[model samples]
Target: MATAATSRGFTMPFNLRLRRADVATLNDKNGVLEMRRKKRRLLTSDWGVVKCCCSDSVVPIRMATGSGNNVEKCEDWRFDMKKSQNSQVVRAPAMRFASPQPRFISKQDKFFPRCSPRNSGPQSRDSPPKRDTGIANEKDWGISLLNENVNESGTNEDGSTWYRESGEDLGENGYRCRWTRMGGQSNDGTSEWKETWWEKSDWTGYKELGVEKSGRNAEGDSWWETWREVLHQDEWSNLARIERSAQKQAKSGTENAGWYENWWEKYDAKGWTEKGAHKYGRLNEQSWWEKWGEHYDGRGSVLKWTDKWAETELGTKWGDKWEEKFFAGIGSRQGETWHVSPRGERWSRTWGEEHFGNSKVHKYGKSTTGESWDIVVDEETYYEADPHYGWADVVGDSTQLLSIQPRERPHGIYPSLDFGSTPPTDEPPDESSTSQ
Candidate 1:
């Protein structure tokens, strides 16, 4: 292994994994072209220069490293050429390699931008570019994802340092979570522990805690204490706002009636909110939701959104003050919403084009709201047990920062549970010590 430090102060390792022919190909065409072959672990600079002594035009060749670790390390490099006595000499462009260190999105980063930069730049390899932090139009808010089993660094106002750890286990049902506000000064911050309590039956009908980190509370529990605490918080809480929900769903089936249920609540000093739905009807491409929700505020305002997929009717009511019924007729399979102003005024709106999948993940949306002033009105789904339990990003109008709910692994140690028929042991048999 060869380690070299770039001018950028980053250390990159060069492994001699290529065969003699391979290294020979990598030789500086300008220098002595000597080649060697070994294990194929060698990596070429994104642009491996092949100099031609003769001339018409000298071109620099580039290659993508799809093996082992070079996946993300490969990047763009420029090659500068000069013609002397009609002979072309290649001088590769200075490369700007992003630090190998992981680029993280803090709990404070509201700008998660897409990998496609708002402005284009030079690229070396063919692999897709990494997401750019939200500096432009797109939000690459992917704080929920990390390379398997890595930890995050965080701090508190008291100048306390916290370490965030994450991972998952798959058995009867996949389980995962993240612990936030943990490992600060004196380990004083609260650790919100969430583990999906799934009733694993080889048979269908599996239920899970849908919301991230909703199960078992962790150390320093200051947030919502009960289901009502979830409903009382008006604003979205780090783990509060009672947005935390539990989900249960029937197995996937084609042409059969598959159903799912999601119940969640939120509360604060002023009032409380509750949302739940049991949507079951055809499976595969034709599934829908039987959604219902109600809210009671101390301020005397009531809200409810319901849907009876059987009759294909979507209903809405605001404290007996205003109500609406949305139905697919004249060929519109959409829903509707209405509101009653505090001043005894009524306003209504309707939408069509129904699309549902996995109890969540909306494909498109209809018009906005006027009476409620909700810029975006939407109806989506949530499930109890999902493979996406730990990695999926929130996809609504929510702007609150979501922490990685913690797991139940031994403190300060990270290890994955292999769910295969034969679980992995601490060590595999040493071939050198085995009998002949």
Candidate 2:
């Protein structure tokens, strides 16, 4: 006789690729997917399970359906079993064809995975309480995987398992600040997983800043690998940003195979200007930007000027480029553009500047292979000005991003990641510390 795999619905996603170090830690002594013949052990608090909310039928059925009697008998047997045994049993209700329940997709299904705090909604019971960690106005920082105390560890109602740990210690920088790491795994229809990091001092306040959410569907064909970050300046006002990159793999026989995009944006206070660029195609392929934009005015309006550029597979080799600056008070707009192409061994470039009805002039390279040019306007010829000829451009000047002094990495941890990297993990505490 053969056994059937348990059918767990979509609870969450699973990792598409485990780290090489994680792959080396899998136990190989027993069968990969089978339980060993051993005595039953009691469940522990550090590994408690939450019974699924939908394990029992919520809607009542009519006696004429014939399932009514079966449900009653099953309930009676379950009561008797509970008195005799301590093990748990999960059962799904039988659905009849006559009065099939209507199912609707949830809001979570509409949005692809993103890391943001949900402010308005009934929170999940498994979610930990919001704690005030005083991340703001703190200067010291440290990372300690060994010192992290298990804050929460349990199974979610959906069959996904989650664990959270928090720790802090005094280091050379100063008194250490609080930080947390939470992650979960699930084998529902798909093997799905999510990890989110929170810290008090990173952004001068408590915020869920870093996240890595990756998982593959049950079929193992469709998958998503995503990483994102958030940074804040204060409790209100505006927020500077962090980086985000997401890769979504397509299913078999799907058009547009699949798409990959990675982009980073930085915002600063001249009313908060944003600059971001994203590229298409696999990460390894030649990176060509798909689109980019810049905005300002407290993020409520676009900047006075806008620039547009399109890139393709040919290494930004050639595409359209244009810029427009608007002056609403004067009811006028200034525009500039350029076109370029690699012809033979040299490059041919054309430049144009337009000021509505006032002036519209064009300039081109002096020759087919020349790099300099001159444009004539109103019977006067002027040489093209070098944008950087006057000032010496200094490169490699590092910007100080943090307002407070830097902190030291906690010792005894695995290879430490600089400012932004995946949080490290430590060995679990002894079994004696865990309680049922």
Candidate 3:
């Protein structure tokens, strides 16, 4: 590659070619012409030659390096015949070449005003220093407080750093506790995130009442959920159970592909039964959540309700919260429903209430572009309450609400369960190795 250095010390590689036919000749001689007159022509004095043999006429000279790197033809570099003949010696502007060493060109060299005697004279000692308009200092932008409370830190064998912190305080019940472990690794652009939970427990033996655990993979494409009864007191029976599961699809041809379910049921020695369930999932561009809880006082009072909400890629949102309570002759039911449009230009709401034997309904709506309405209807009625309405009425023989059956693998939630003391590895384990 042939390289040419600019006056500014920058080198650029390019090919140059000049044919013999392109060379200029005077009196049948190339480059040098036999002196036939007193007049002379000068190309440049800086390159050493002041006078050239010949009549005072412009002679185009084609230059070719011995290495074959020749100059291209340019009209601007040639002298005019009239101008050369009228003057004793005509000289072209001196050409400058760059040094072999390379130099960096900064913005100040091209964009900023330069200091010279013509524009800017020498500064006086009494004058203030000029301000630099370059990058601003970090203090001017405000300091980050992320590492303010980092008490203990250390480097891992993998070259990543880890931090550990813990605190405790006395409270009305006993003492509150907190612990945290976090760090990151740059090997694969992977970060490790883990949180420590402080459960509400007595200072003596902070028994594991119940477990609430949740986690998501690095890609965020997969999620895991778990909830179980860890403290099985004598009041609870072996039948008491809880578990969770998750499902995920590969990235190819899949949209919003993830599902999670959680369920738990517990019974006390006093005969009070507690059961609840939660389920949610995504399909295509839409996602939804469903949850309902049930409680039996062991007498005749029972409460059951369902809460659900859903949103779509179109920005539309809707939800419902409804519940019903029944005893002997005293029964009450209430429900609320709402929906929102994609552009928030329109919305609708409907709600109703029932107590003993009276009921009322109210609804409000906002239409698109200058249209809206509000309505409320009150209905007075009396009817005999269902005295036999109870738990048996909702579930006949099975303890599990067949409709609320949750299915998934549990990633273990008990405090006693050993989730490795070491932080999660920076890289996710290979599937093949994990399966084995």
> Which candidate achieves the best TM-score against the true structure?
2
Model 1 stretches astray by more than 4 angstroms: 1-241, 252-255, 283-288, 311-436
Task: List where candidate 3 sits over 4 angstroms from the true fold.
Answer: 1-231, 234-253, 357-436
Q: Mind giving the per-residue lDDT tens digits that candidate 1 earns over 1-436?
A: 1111011101111111222222222221112111233333323442223222211111111222111111222222223223211322212222121112113433333233212221221111111111111011012213233334644555445443444444544443223322222122323333222221111111111111222222111222121111101111111221123234433332221223233333443333223333333323222222222334444443433343343222111121121011211211111122343343334454444433322332221222233343222222243321111111111111111222221232333445433333356532312122211110
Greater-lDDT candidate between 2 and 3: 3
> Over the stretch 1-436, how does candidate 3's per-residue lDDT look in tens digits?
1111011000000011111121121121111111122222222212122122212121212111111111111211233335543432222211111011113434433232122122221111111111111111122212111222335555545454444443443354343323222323323433232323222233222222112222222343222222222212222222222121112111211233443344444443233555454544445555555555566666656676666555556566655455556565345444454565566743434333333433443333343344444454454432212112122211221112111111221355222322355643222122211100
- Ranking according to TM-score, highest score first: 2, 3, 1
Given candidate 2, what's the lDDT at residue 297?
A: 40
Across 1-436, the per-residue lDDT of candidate 2 in tens digits comes to: 1111110111101121212111112111111111123322222321012122222222111110010011111111111223222222211112111112113425542232222233221112111111111111111111223234546667756676656655664443232444455555563534443343333232132122233334333334233333333333322333332222233322212222233333333333223433333323221211122333333444233332222222223232322223223232111222222233323232334343322223333332233455555453332212111111000100000011121222433454332223434432211122211110
Q: Provide the lDDT at 168 for model 2.
A: 60
Question: Which pairs of residues collide in candidate 2?
Answer: 13-191, 13-192, 13-193, 14-191, 14-192, 14-215, 45-435, 135-200, 136-204
Question: What TM-score goes with each of the models?
Answer: 0.21, 0.34, 0.30
Compared to the true structure, candidate 1 yields what TM-score?
A: 0.21
Top lDDT prediction, candidate number: 3
